[model samples]
Target: MTTNHLELSGRILRSRRFDSPAGIHHTVLQLEHKSLKTEANMQRQVYCVIQVILSGERFERLTDKLKAGVDIQVSGFIALQQSRNGQSRLVLHAENVELKN
Candidate 1:
């Protein structure tokens, strides 16, 4: 058995909209995450920018509310971002989201 779950809290750097072939609404966002973590007995500051996608009703509800620089907590699964160029990328498919100050 395998598991593919992710939980992240970060600032939304940007957002855009696209439609599926079946006319379903989809929202894609760029999130920036930063934190201090202890690894190998040392503390380090880690930072990363990730892509996140939202679909269905959640997409509609969050489309306008999620502005750039908004801090939010997201829980979801990780999926590959398919590209025609054969490049493999990781994307977070958000299942739940919450706004935070």
Candidate 2:
């Protein structure tokens, strides 16, 4: 089977919970990742911002704790963000999130 897995460790930039039409609980988070990467023998700072979704029971359990500036590691799959403006982007659908100190 083809897998589209993604694991990210970063600080939460934003988090919010909302219910879907089918009554499913969902939490969306904006994660900010920053690290140093070596390119051509030079170390450069790299940064990325991504959207992540935590759904179902996990959302219900974590909604109260997850907030901006919290560090965490999330593992999940990458999917295309559905949009009406034809400007879709890649989003991570989190299966699990580990809280970090």
Question: Could you tell me every candidate's TM-score relative to the true structure?
Answer: 0.91, 0.91
lDDT of 2 by residue, 1-101 (tens): 89788998999999988899999999999999999999999999999999999989755867788899999999999988868988989999998898899
Scored by lDDT, model 2 comes in at 0.91
lDDT of 2 at 74: 94
Backbone clashes in model 2, listed as residue pairs: none
lDDT measured at residue 74 in model 1 versus the true structure, 0 to 100: 93
Worst 10 residues of 1 by lDDT: 56-65
- Which runs in model 2 stand beyond 4 Å of their true positions? none
How do the residues 1-101 of candidate 1 rate in per-residue lDDT, one tens digit apiece? 99989999999999888899998898889999999999999999999999999998755876798889899999899988778999989999999988898
Q: What is the lDDT of residue 11 in candidate 2?
A: 97
